[model samples]
Target chain A: MINRIRHILLLYLRETSFVLLFWVLVLGVLFAHFLFTDLDFHQWLVRYITTTQYPVFSIWSSVMLGAGIWITCLLGWMFKVQYAHPRSSLLPHYRSSHLMVGWICYLLIVIGAIWVIHVGGSFYQDTSDKQFAFFVAAVFFSAFNLILGYISWPTFAVVLWGMLCLFSNYEYFILTQILGEFLTNVFVLILTSSALLLLTWRLFHLKEEHWEYPYLFSWTRTSQRQHDALLTTLLDMVEKRLPSHQKHKPLKILRWDVLRFSIYKTILFFSAIILPFYLLYIKALSEYFLSFYQSPFKYFLLCAYSVIVIFGFHLRSISLWGRELLFPMERKRFIKEKGMNLLIQIYLLWLFLFILIILLPYMLLMPEFLMTAKFWSEILLTACFPLAGFGALTSLRDLSPRQSAFAFLGIVTITIFQMMQIKNLDVPILLMESFAWLFIGVLLIKMSYHKWCQTEF
Target chain B: MKNDIIDVKNVTKCFGSKKVLDDLSFQVGQGSVFGLLGKNGSGKTTLIKSILGLVRPQHGNITTLGDDPWCFQESTKEKIGYVPQMDSLYPWLRIKEMVEYTASFYSRWNSNLVNELIEDWGLNPQDRIGTLSVGESQKVSIILSLGHEPELLVFDEPVASLDPFARRQFLKTLIEIITRRPCTIFFSTHITSDLERITDHVALLHQGKIMFCGELDELKTRGNLNLEEIFLEMTR
Candidate 1:
């Protein structure tokens, strides 16, 4: 059983890098927290017992428990594979009994680790004035052990045990305030041991019984053909869009349009208009604004400006002209056609934003906050340049729907930085916005020309 | 005399360490119905995919209509029509919309023939492809494949999901189409009876290799037994 378990573990290690990476990340987090954080480790445990925020705690606990269940399930899966298809090449064949013994050994190591962490945390807490370093170490080790144990057990059992432990600790703290810490530690140990015993019994029953292995590994030939066909179609699509013989300039233009029009519309809308409005709403609801700011309307206007600038960038990005490849046209013709389409989309979006801005003063009941005609002209100029730059950036990135999530994050981060930088400028906000817009426009035109020159299709 | 439409030579494919198709070689002549017979895991589909240029083989060459299937040039692609084992039509598209959309891809699309097939298959032009039953979907797939008036047709397990009556009707339609056009029809199926009725040439594949490839009557005469018995004997 020990040998079998070792073989299974060895096979698992060979098969998956996810488990190794998971452990590495977990250990790294623990090490960092212990070395850097000023958090009181023992007090943190007490807080877990007393906390009433069940929703947050329950989610965290379930995540920990789910990891443990997956690990146990993986072991069962490996064992079944070995039993069904024994490797003749594996030297010094191990008995199933040896595997059972190995499982028990693994369980003991896990239980022992958990017991040590719990005992160490409790001991340090009882002896007040313990060094911060020692306390941190104890907490870190405890957290690591708890995580490992949770992953080692069945999913449901781990969840049940975690809930039981939390409630039992709470009850013990309430019933016996003086000896609560020690009693809780003892209870955790007892529960862990009992759960391990129950798991062992279950494993034994599973071993003795002739269980039907789920045929999860079987691949239907028809399904395989369909998958292959899809890949082939995708390859064909890609090849058609980016032909080998085409020059870089025209190909880039075509690629830009394709990326823009296909599945990027929703992303553009959210990043530009929707996201800015949400930020404005958040600012209005904030206590800082409510207490100090005289005009909530000004904040709304500012948000609207930010939205316009951000929307310009997104619009440019979405319209980078990649989609013209789908139609049967020469690279030069495709580039020209797509460029026209993009220009039209840009014009429409700008028109929509202009109309919205014009109506904002009346709808929002803050005519004074509205930009002056001169300010509007300056803002449009600044917005146009940056929007063009944003379009160029999007084309350069060749963004896909899968990468849109990360792109939105990048947009938000950039918007925050730009907004902060522009606020401190001595020049009028409108003028600054215009300059930014113009800069982006020049970049877009230059990039668009460069793309048309470089692309080969 | 050189009537071959598909000629695969020394074809090999592997997924990880397991070789799914090992040095496979075969040919399907023009104007003849070819049956590729294989068990559940045999490399029939892999061979079909390689022929269609869906999968690039690790080693060897496949020529379909005297051109690389992977090229998918307008002229090369126009010569062949394929009905995949599963329906590949966009489920959201209505029958008429799908036909029109597919028709756009081919220069030689026959709208009249497509309309005829739609009526023959009892398919409603306005119904979504997703709403169709398995047999109905197969009929739509067949209609789509035939709409382009290709010189060669490739179908993988065309009647695997069809009812007996539907299967018979599908075969009858297939036979009539092949007879009218004199196009090479390459179809893969597990059912030997279907092959026996319509197929002029047969290739029996077992464990990633062709057990036999010849005229169906020749194979029957050589073994002095029926095709089903011969298949079972060869596979075993």
Candidate 2:
């Protein structure tokens, strides 16, 4: 039985090695940040916890822990495991008894690693008293809910998650305060244990039929409606997220009404204006701004912000132009038409940003807190071209997702650096930057046209 | 020009180091029901895709309906109907919606024929495509391809998933449609018995090359072997 459990655990770990490695990398970064820099994630977390009341530490910590548990458990559940009846094995009760063992092994490693880092230290004891006991109970429920979620209705897990977060947030809850914290946990433990006993019975009572529930731990649609619903959600997401225009449109190469690309452009264009005001609503955002405002990372943050805008602008264009090349008819005409559409979308997006920047002072009703006309001109010229230019420069095959993202960052960084070196938002320097971007954008567009003409699917 | 509906000439398509179609050449004339027989990975699908202009061969010319297969115009596309080996139908839409969406693309769409066929197939138009079984989805794909009443129909393993009843009905439907109007039909299939029933011209594909290309009766008379035996012998 022990060897079977170990074998199952090893098999699962091997299958999900990439996901486990990604999680390990994230944890490694957090640990390294603590070790290398003065910034201790734990200490910072401790500070964040102390600031909020009602055992703010306990509730928030549980929410964080619950999210982690949910993520890991959800990843485990995504993989559908098959049950093989090993004739020689001692564990002969359930067809998927090994799966239960695998889940146990999974929870142990993930939760145990988190405990060693977060709760193992003296800092956890120093942070809050109520947190330690509250967290232990929260994690137990989270694990029980997510795994059992697949076997039963998935909504049961969602409800359990909601209950955990909701109950933890309330300071005046009668159950927690009157029943005492340890007693409340004891009640949940009994509740979970009873549920587990029911689950064990269900697991053991296996049938040769029920193709959907091939394994005891497997997730399957109870009805045709459930299957359709799952598939609809998946297909809708794939359709929406596929980087082409909404409709196939006319046989013409360059029509403008691609719904998907237009949606992002409209959102990004509006957000450039609306996001600043929305930031004002969140008091923490302004405080966050001030923190960066005083820090050395301020310039780096600004560059990142610009890169995000440029990246967002070109992201869909890569798909739009890439898809157009795959069409059976019209080579040159499609290129010319698609190029025009690309320019129009970029120009329109920039126009929205320009209008927002211009109207901001009047909307805020501030006279002294105003920018020069040079600033508006600078915004109009520089913002429109670089993103589209860089987008046109890269092909679907030439650069990977990581490469394009880094390239966008690189472009923004260089543009900012050049502007900073000049130390002026003067007309000539702005115009030079504008011309450079325009020239590059047009040149890249032409280069892409050539590549599109030649490349095959 | 030579009364050929499909003219694949000296087509050599390679994927990286391996050649999928090695100087493969074949033609299907108008009013001929041609069956392409091949083993798995014998480039039957690749050859079909190349003829449809979905795939472009590196070194050769393929002409479909007097137009370049690689750059098939709108008019040329209107005349061709294709059913792929695996139908990639969107699951979010209902059967009615899927039919309508496919119908919208073709200028020569036969809505009456499509509706009649859908009804005959016993498929509920209101049912979402995602709720369909594999055989049902294949039926939807066939209806989509046939709705245009295309002059040249191409199918890659069109009835691989159908049950015995559905397969009989499907083959009956194809025969009924073809009898109504003379059309060029080219399809690849593993079912040799079905091929013998439907096709007049049979082509055997082996190792990216055509080992046999002629009338089914001619091969049966000359070789004195059934299609399954012929296919096995050719592939082996």
Candidate 3:
């Protein structure tokens, strides 16, 4: 029993260490830069703290609640690969207590870490926020996290998703005016209690899950002929942009398992990112063109900014581009093909997303913007720049999504914020900005081609 | 009252319209050592996967331990230990850790036996499964499968990567286990002698169809040739 617990603990710790390392390295640098070089950043953060509608206690508790929920989710997900196969349940005499205890240990560590982050960030905070009510809220949030952590991961995932939906789109659930106000105030509590009840049932009544769904999303293993055609079409498009000599024999498509798994693997990230937009769009429709911050068009521009950041960050999925050793194609040609593939994929994705967004509640929310040239321009610039830039920049060097995502978002946020201050963006400014982004995007892509040519896979 | 531990009936599996297992039906009796043999891409692995519920056959029913292999219950799964042709051990885990983790799943785990086997196999407990040679990785996988002392052990080309000495030792182990515990073993292999030495019943899978499923001795007597020659003739 001790041995099993020890093993589980060790595994959890190892995973936790990797997670911590990424955060420390990224956040440490971010803090150092803002603390030292960027006085304006400090000013902005202070302003953000002061201008928020919520009081300090509410603010800190809300932050902790979000972190607590996220941490529980992370812990629950850490074992997914290890426990994916149903065979993991075949152990006959093993009790669920070990798993329960392991989850408790994870919860404690996470709560501690959250507290540390709270304390560290509140270096210049007032002491009034540390009242009994604040403590109660913190306790409640931590306790809720424990319940979430101990539940079956699929249950946790579903509940978490539902909670996010409820929190984001609760207005839809507000059946009556009297109940709606009450629901808004204690929705977190309601969700926590509901999850706890479900988890209690799961732990005792429904222990030994029999129903295991196959992957929700999977890549179809297409025919070799189909694969070949895909490659040929990709090559043909790329070849048009390349020198005549670059038009060579079709290299054997090294079958990437990623071709089958990438979307499913990244689905969690996709969902988490898209959920807010889903809610915001609903709110926009509800308020007749206004979201919390701006008009739906402007809010979508912000999302477009986000889309560019995501494209830049994820441009360097090494698996997507790392096939230099597998094929005999020259580096330039390989990079060109890869770049075109990425641009095409991103363009298709963004096009689909943009169309869907406009077709939905946003259709009624910003009905006039769809017909406007300004909106079209916004859509084009959003799709074109990132698609072009990432297509090129990623070719130059393999980049990590998490690390690069942060840096790219920071740059995009700062630039967008500055640009937003300019109340009027005339046609010339819009054209100039759009053209410049395209120029820079294309130039980087061209440079990346040369850079990749000389480098190893 | 069918006495068979495994029963496959008209199992037709297709991959992109190409039939991998076409109307495949067979039975292996309780405590019998069954050898599944076929040439590469002849659907040996696919058949095994179908039986294990890793892959679903479009038109067939498979029962192992008298329960449906497709969505088999934990109780049923506990009775069977399976090793695939290729090493499927978690790459990130050390051999020892993997053993311990795998043991946690089984109703019955013979820790002493697992330890003895790992030591006998000369596999380092601390070595990550990924760092080991293919042969060494296979040994770890074999140990994990046997740790629970399953009533039925299935191996797909179990000793394909092992050296001659290890192969001989493994065969010896199999024989000893079968005699002592009266367990059923269903394994696939390219090795003819290994089949000839241990398998009481041999089935030749060809072009997704069973060409022969009968007593090994009867097959040899009927063919008037060694298992190797019989295999070649059937496959050809």
Candidate 4:
């Protein structure tokens, strides 16, 4: 049994070396921060338990929790791959015992991390400080396990949200309030830990997970063919609503726009639905954001801009051009019309995003603050660069989508840096930047047009 | 004897250092069931793709339907159908929807023929293409190609994914289409029995070269062996 366990451990290490490396990096940074900082680490721990806001601690804990989630997902995927297969499910490889062992392995790692933190701090800390550290670690670990359980069994998340709604004030359920109970009495800690362990055990023993196999197959496998399937599904959903089967022949150019715009439209729809709820969540946790900024609207602008720009880079997929190559169309007309179609989609997306940016300030209850002429100029100047840069990159036949994405990111970073270097928001500077962007965009577009005309499949 | 539907002359296609097709030459006669036999990586797919203008040969000339395939006119395209080896169908569309979408591209589409084939093949038109099995998706792809009723049909290993029963049914449909119209079929497959059943002429491609290009009966009579035996002897 010991040798078997070791073999499985080694197998997991070999398969999931990247996740393990990330875990080690997180712990290493935390230790370095704790050891190298001038502040007393023990006092920081005490303050973290007592205070509501500790930005540095919060960031570290979030990183730690994120690493925990990453490790959990990787381990779960390893087990799921074998069990998801039809014939492999009948084999002896993935058993309930193996699942429990995997979870226990994860649990031991978290416990070891807490132990190291405690041992490293014992030079100047006392027993009370020890208990505080233990309670905080318990809360973090419990949150991690609960989240995993909630994901494994989605009904639990619904019940959890319902329970949260029943409370009159969210203050009653904040992390410090939960920790206060843990620090004041030992019984609460024991009961909560037992309940978390019981939940984890139940989650690990779930046998009827065949329903999730299809989703797992697509999510875990990132092949070009699967990517094409995803694009096809998105495009078909949009195409179905259009009058595809009208009496007269459908406009091929309009159909082409539908294909190009499907991804952006779906993303924009989801963003519209989620952004409001996200703002409300930020409102509920206003104390956290209040320390960094007076209003969440600025963050919203940043997020919205980043989302639109990030999606712009993803619009041109590698395998997508292959789908249209076999169609019987004049090559020159196809190229010229494709350029027109792309420009139209880019303009439409720009219009929709501008309206979204305008509406977001109103939604966050800061309508007047962001309506200045300078803000408008800034938005206009920056908005088209991402789409233009990415669209021009799409026309280049040599770069793969991944390489193009990296290039887009590099260009975006340089442009942002240049904009940031400008101290004054003068009209002349804004106009110059906008015109420069236009010149570069048009130049790249022209170059790509010629390249595309000469390209063979 | 018959006017050639597809003509290839000294086609040489190279992928970097590897030569996939070397100075290949062959002619597919009009209204004939032509079968191309080759081993794995023997450039059968490359040759078919060249004929359909999906691939450009480095040094050669290919003409299909009396026009350069590289720059086939819209009218020429309307009269040609191609079924690629892998079915790259829109998984989100239903079989009926896929047929309609493909039909929109061609000027001439036979809806009655499409419906008849779908029904005869025991396929549900409402079923989503993604959820269908590999053989079912292949059937839909075959149906999509046949819907336009093209004068020339180019198939690259069309029966690779189909089961034996579906393959037999597909060959039967091919025979029916041949009897029903003056259509030309050019296909490549590994299944010798299926080829022997349907093909009138055969071409053996080995090491990017054609070893035989003639009537199946002539080759069989010369070798005094079955089609599979002849293929092994020639390729070996």
The C-alpha RMSD in Å for every predicted model, in order, reads: 23.1, 21.7, 8.9, 21.4
Residue clash pairs of candidate 2:
A246-A259
CA lDDT, candidate 3, residue A14 = 52
Give the per-residue lDDT of model 3 (tens digit) for B48-166: 87887767788979988898775567678778888877755666678888888777656579999899888888988999877899999988888888888999899989999999989
Q: TM-scores for chain B, in order?
A: 0.96, 0.97, 0.97, 0.97
DockQ of each: 0.02, 0.01, 0.22, 0.01
Location of the lowest summed lDDT over 10 successive residues in candidate 4 chain B: B98-107
After superposing candidate 3 on the true structure, give the runs of residues whose Cα lies further than 4 Å from its correct spot. A1-285, A288-291, A295-331, A347-363, A366-392, A395-443, B1-32, B40-77, B86-94, B112-138, B159-182, B207-210, B222-224
Better of 2 and 4 by TM-score: 4
Query: Candidate 3, residues A1-457: lDDT per residue as tens digits?
Result: 5566676666555554345645754675476456546456545444332232323322233333344456555554544433444244334423353456545665575456444334433532234333222333433455455544433344334335323322221221121221223334266446645765554344332212223222211122343335445545665576677787855433222223223324322433445676677657566446522442232223333334334533543455554556444677766666666555555545544555555444454464657756876666655555555644464445434556665556455545544453443336655666666677778777777777677767654
Local distance difference test scores for all models: 0.56, 0.59, 0.60, 0.61
lDDT of 3 at B208: 90
Clashing pairs in 3: A91-B105, A91-B106, A92-B107
TM-score of chain A of each: 0.32, 0.42, 0.56, 0.55
Give TM-scores for every candidate, taking all chains together and pairing residue i with residue i: 0.38, 0.38, 0.62, 0.43
Model 4 misplaced regions, further than 4 Å = A1-83, A93-277, A290-317, A332-362, A395-397, A415-428, B1-236
On a 0 to 1 TM-score scale, where does candidate 1 land against the true structure? 0.38
Docking class of 1: incorrect
